[model samples]
Target: MAHYERDLTGNVDDLVAHLDRAIPQGSISAKYEAGSDHRVGDARMLVRAYERYSALGGNRVSLCISVLAVGEEMSLSMVSAGGSEAVFFKVNTFGEEAFLERAIQALESYPG
Candidate 1:
């Protein structure tokens, strides 16, 4: 099984390393708009990346972490041979945090 992991820590090197490790030989044609290097500025960018990647015939998974003055949030999603799934959790960031946590958990626990 291939493993892909990404953290929204704004760490470009870490993101690149994870992509390199996760993608199989010749599986990934390229890396488009990784969250590292500030290439991913918003949720729209992320969604677009995933859509494009999926079109390329590869599994795509993403974990996004967002920090705000009020609190923090985490989001997770998967797109692959099994299909596509996404969830959001919202917790300390008011109600948004709970959504983020739940989304991540659901996507992670999904049988697919």
Candidate 2:
């Protein structure tokens, strides 16, 4: 699993927008993990999981992206999975850097 922590300087709206845009293309599922029950940044904490496919046509892996708020800032956490089960027992490892680069970059560059 890969992990990253960033100090984000922005309001909830700006943070949400940045997170929303950084998500990779795939069918995603999200839910509140803490704080308020609302769907937006009001939740204070959110977890998203999505499927990733390999080019060689094998088992798909499930990766997770978690967002949480601390005081006046927010942070993103990403975890990678190795599809080592059944057909994916010997499959190639996924490159998590490619998946998270955009999101991390967005956070570092976001002005607000």
Q: Which ten residues in a row have the lowest lDDT in candidate 2?
A: 29-38
Q: Which candidate gets the maximum lDDT versus the true structure? A: 2
Error of 2 at 9 (Å): 2.2
Model 2: per-residue lDDT, tens digit, 36-102?
A: 2235444477566555544433445555666677557667676656444446355344434434454
Model 1 scores a TM of 0.22
* Lowest-sum lDDT 10-residue window in model 1: 65-74
Per residue, candidate 1 scores C-alpha lDDT tens digits across 1-112 of 1122333334333333343333322224323334432233432223313111334223343333322211122232332221233234311222222223333443344332
- Candidate 2 lDDT at 11 equals 75
Q: Candidate 1: which stretches are off by over 4 Å?
A: 1-13, 25-44, 47-73, 82-112
Off by over 4 Å in 2: 25-43, 83-91, 109-111
Q: Measured by C-alpha RMSD in angstroms, how accurate is candidate 2? A: 5.7
